[model samples]
Target: IMHLPFRGRLKLLVASLTAIILLTWLYLLAGNLENGRSLLLSPCLSETPEARVLERVVLESRVREMEEENRQIRLQLNQLQGTVGQPADGGNYGNAAWGASADTGPEDVENTAEERANHTECPRSPTILKCELIHVACVCAGHNASRDVVTLVKSILFHRRNPLHFHFITDAVANQILSSLFQSWMVPSVQVSFYDADELKSEVSWIPNKHYSGIYGLMKLTLTKALPSDLTKVIVLDTDITFATDIAELWAIFRKFTDKQVIGLVENQSDWYLGNLWKNHKPWPALGRGFNTGVILLYLERLRRIGWEQMWRLTAERELMSMLSTSLADQDIFNAFIKQNPVLVHQLPCFWNVQLSDHTRSEQCYTEVSDLKVIHWNSPKKLRVKNKHVEFFRNLYLTFLEYDGNLLRRELFGCPSQATSESVRLQGALEELDEDDQCYDFRRERITVHRVHLYFLQYEYTPAGDDTDVTLVAQLSMDRLQMLEAICKHWEGPISLALYMSDAEAQQFLRYAQASEVLKNRKNVGYHIVYKEGQFYPVNLVRNVALRNANTPYVFLADVDFLPMYGLYDYLRHFLSILQLGCNVTKCYVKKSRVLNTFQKHCMQSSSKLLLTHLYTSLSPCRPRYHVWTKGHAPTNYAKWRTATTPYKVEWEADFEPYVVVKRDCPEYDQRFVGFGWNKVSHIMELDAQEYDLMVLPNAFMIHMPHAPSFDISKFRSSPGYRYCLQTLKEEFHQDLSRKYGAAALKYLTAQRNI
Candidate 1:
């Protein structure tokens, strides 16, 4: 510390302070660099895999944030550089600029201000993107049209997340309802405006009114004048159409149009134009090039240039209109215009506008449902359709309407006031009326039957059933008379022994039955012999014959060798008697039932429906081989039988062809399955397709009698022709099912089973 002058000391102090400040700055910069490095390596030292994953997710989120910021910056830069296109009318239409932009003059700002004032009352989204807004137009002139509009609007809103402006060309009443609906829904990113249909009608007065098409058709022609001049393009849709995908995706079609193309539309699915317009004359070069107007993309700017008045003049020309199909009306006009100037029209994919007029044509045009963006119920309105395909579309329409503040309240809830009052009145009247007068009108009701069958006698052994009597339809041979006699002696129930064989074999069976004391002495038993000449067993044919010939309203199609357990016939008759009163019986099977060894003498002597039921009830809750029958078995309550039942067409039950108790009216067994493969299962599947309910009885069981193997394994293995025939028959059954129900029906059946 040297003593220095005061000025020197002050200068030294200032210099020292400056040096410390610089050092502090350097240290801070180094510390920040070290912190950055540590942060970069922290993920590597994460204590657990979850921490590392979380760190990566955070980094990804940050990266996305930065990318979005960068995009915004670029957009701002482009806007400042004047790359966004200006509106042709020099007004701000609130549409995002995409094309090149130009410098705005004072006049432009003034015009924009004026336009904004005019649309100040119109609702708009505060956070809409700076992109071109989609303009959509629809006509609402009648109650049906109004309802359709509500559904269409809801569908669009459900699928579209982009900003749009909906222009509704409608009457005053519809406009009010639409406005109220939009307000109630609190829809976002959408601005709705109404244009009077009467205005368009007045403008196009020169065009003659056609019964084939209403004034709604003329409203579409006025889009060039009806819409604001600022709108460059618009998507015109029919009220009857519903959107399945984003409206923005359909709006993108406008970009695909060439410079010369003014409209984009899907081709007409039907040949109405070719058949009606081009008939009895040399068809035009574009005869089949007609387009449907259900979904149309109009280039409003181009239409303005072409002059809407000019189009109206063409429509007014009686001779020109006469040349086109009167039935087609406006569609014919559009086709004629496109024919003359094909360059003006752009053909779109058929899926964009799936016209639901002819199902065959629609199926041929759009093969996959995923490809459909919009469904147009054109010919038969959705409300009037009865076909399944049309019904599906109708359901979608109703669902959308329901979503839109229950627009279908009357249809779905049935006018609450009237329904409630009527129901209360009916209840009161019924209480006062006598029960005897409450007769049901069952004349129009038809019973649906579920069919099932049993395959038996593959090993050739007699079954024991001293307490049960059931119709035993057996495919007989000359050697099986002893087996039949034994079965007849054991079973105490009525028997319809159906024998399917050659004429000689049938005669032999009849002679044997006549001679056997067991069969002839039993007054309840009868024999039906059907002569079938073939090496292959026509089991299904004989089963069908037995089913038809059986006198009982309820029939059990079982093999001759099957033995009904002790209480099986008693329980079955009880169940059937109740079923005949009201229930529609489809399929019935026993619980915990199995095929026992034919050589086991003790099993046949001791086994009965009662013993089986007791054994099943005593066992643990483990699943049995045939668990469906015993699943819901309550010995005392018959109504609980349904609990043990499952859908007959389920995957697990695909091969479970047990003895089925079916009503007489069930569809006959398929006779094409001449051999063992699919004879029983095919009939069960057909019944399942008919949507019949099935039942399972746990208390009543039947033991299948073991028989010799009917199919010769060695022969089948060596014979390719036999295997091929089996495969061919299966394929034919599949083809028949497809032709009747549809190719998707089989797929749906499999899917249902998996679920």
Candidate 2:
């Protein structure tokens, strides 16, 4: 029987005995754990001291080897599972799902998101009337995590057939983005609520888990507490995965769960739990193969009835005595509990998870499955996974990654009484158009006017007033986006950028943003789009849009043409802090806790001046109000400002057009003023009327870079009708301010003849 030398044969025999003894102990450990007894107390080991010592040596050796392997694979495991200890920027975590081609097999599977989302392929059920929601939940953290979450929601929306409710456990940044995103999409049948993960952190903070995802990953275990008590069932998902089929079908499995079965999970498709990855591999014990926690269907009421918290907590405590800290966090504990309480688990079909890890043996799952339901690239390599069929999955995921999120906004099926979606309304109106009309401009005017599509949902949120952060809020046309890099560099703070342009310009700007180094990578910038829907530019409307969306307490409302002097942003924050100025201290809520915000101008005592370039001197000043314009600039008294070390108040002058940092709730610009003349003048006048200090800052500078005139400015100079309308609007504005404040509004200005 021995082909090898005598020593080699002896070594092989020794190794075989070692494997047998290890497996035997493992078998006893698994059985003993099920009976709530440690392997140390097993009768097979005997009550003898020698057997106890042997058992200790074997078990200790196993745990040490496993820990070493875990340390080596922690990073790889985190990426594979779609969760990371640190928040990645735009592209780190892969947001994709494997899409195996359609194979002929048995059909009629059902899954989708219903009840809280607007679905187009509405099932003939009374989902809308009965409000039968397919409630889904996700645990998300980090700044760019929303990118994956967005794709996950898109997949749900893509296959959903009824009303859906989304429950999100998120940090502040994620909550801000998701709340704003869903609000802007305005999907009729969908509703989403956010629970702060930070608030739930204390629930799991006591657990000593060393999983690569850290405590954020443990948030899943606290789902029964984090979610509302009324939420009886929820389909929990990780951010890295996307559903290839209807999620309603997955939700349908909850009805299939037995009274004792509280959690539905897919088995680990890889041979990981079989201890075959390596001879020394001693992963957490699982039944047959382990259970993956990436996608879970929880029967919340059942879990609570079974005292899930106490049961799992006791389980974690017991495992921790020997394992120290879990290697897989929630997944490990879940499997450990399932091992002890087998009846509590309901296994879902492998098609639902479709795990695509490097060591995956999920190919057996592909046999006769009609459609690839949920393709989990549960590997760090993602699209570059070792699988030969990865390209097909890559292409399918890219389709959704580059998808136009705007297209997902469709009319809610089963809600006939509600207003139609833009597509439906536009399609209906287009039928009324002349058959000969093929011109782009004619169709745009008729179709686009029916939809109010100005929104900027692309933003990250940190809770307001977490610090004394100032945001530069500015408005510009798409032509001026090239100036974004310079301004973003010099200003050195977050920004709220609002643009008024055509739809084509918006698309062009998006492409430019993706290609540009600064625009693409920067997470602090928020883009608000207002396409050119009207003839003359609504300059005030654009300004108001930027100001309203600025999350910071202080907003430096400047024209896009101007760049703040370097370090002016930090300087303002410093000056404001010294003066104890708030962003006007408004009350807002963060998970029911109060947050305070302040305005910038409320504390404008920086040791700097609001400096402007010589662009004014270079340009022709042949307008009718030349003296008033020059006099407004002259009021700063630069003669003293040049040597001054502190701020001095400047009496508000008519036509001043001041560029100042103000609070969140600053005066709104007059909507009545369109095109060029008196647009800024009316806003400054309103600020004066409201008594916000117009202080002259020393050493601070606002440089007006040279730029071509806007379309409205060019029109104002040539068209007499445009000039006439401007004059009339100015007259009415002055008259109205005079009526409201009864001449006190004019108190701040040096009165002059009408232009």
For this target, which candidate reaches the highest TM-score against the unseen true structure?
2
Question: For candidate 2, lDDT tens digit of each residue in 311-372?
Answer: 99999889878777877788988988887766567777667787887878666555543557
- Error (Å) of candidate 1 at residue 438 is 52
Candidate 2 lDDT at 140 equals 80
Residue ranges of candidate 1 with Cα displaced over 4 Å: 1-131, 276-289, 315-321, 381-392, 404-755
Q: What is the lDDT, from 0 to 100, of the residue 533 in candidate 1?
A: 36
Show model 2 residue runs off by greater than 4 Å.
1-131, 258-260, 362-364, 367-370, 377-382, 387-389, 402-407, 416-471, 475-482, 493-554, 570-656, 663-665, 669-681, 706-753
In model 2, what lDDT does residue 277 have?
Answer: 90
Error of 2 at 489 (Å): 3.6
Model 2 quality (TM-score): 0.62
10 residues in a row with least lDDT, candidate 2: 590-599
lDDT of each prediction vs. the true structure?
0.55, 0.66
Over 514-625, each residue of candidate 1 has an lDDT whose tens digit, in order, gives 6877665765554444434335556676677567645555567666655555555556666555544543343243221211111122235545444433443444221122
TM-score of each: 0.36, 0.62
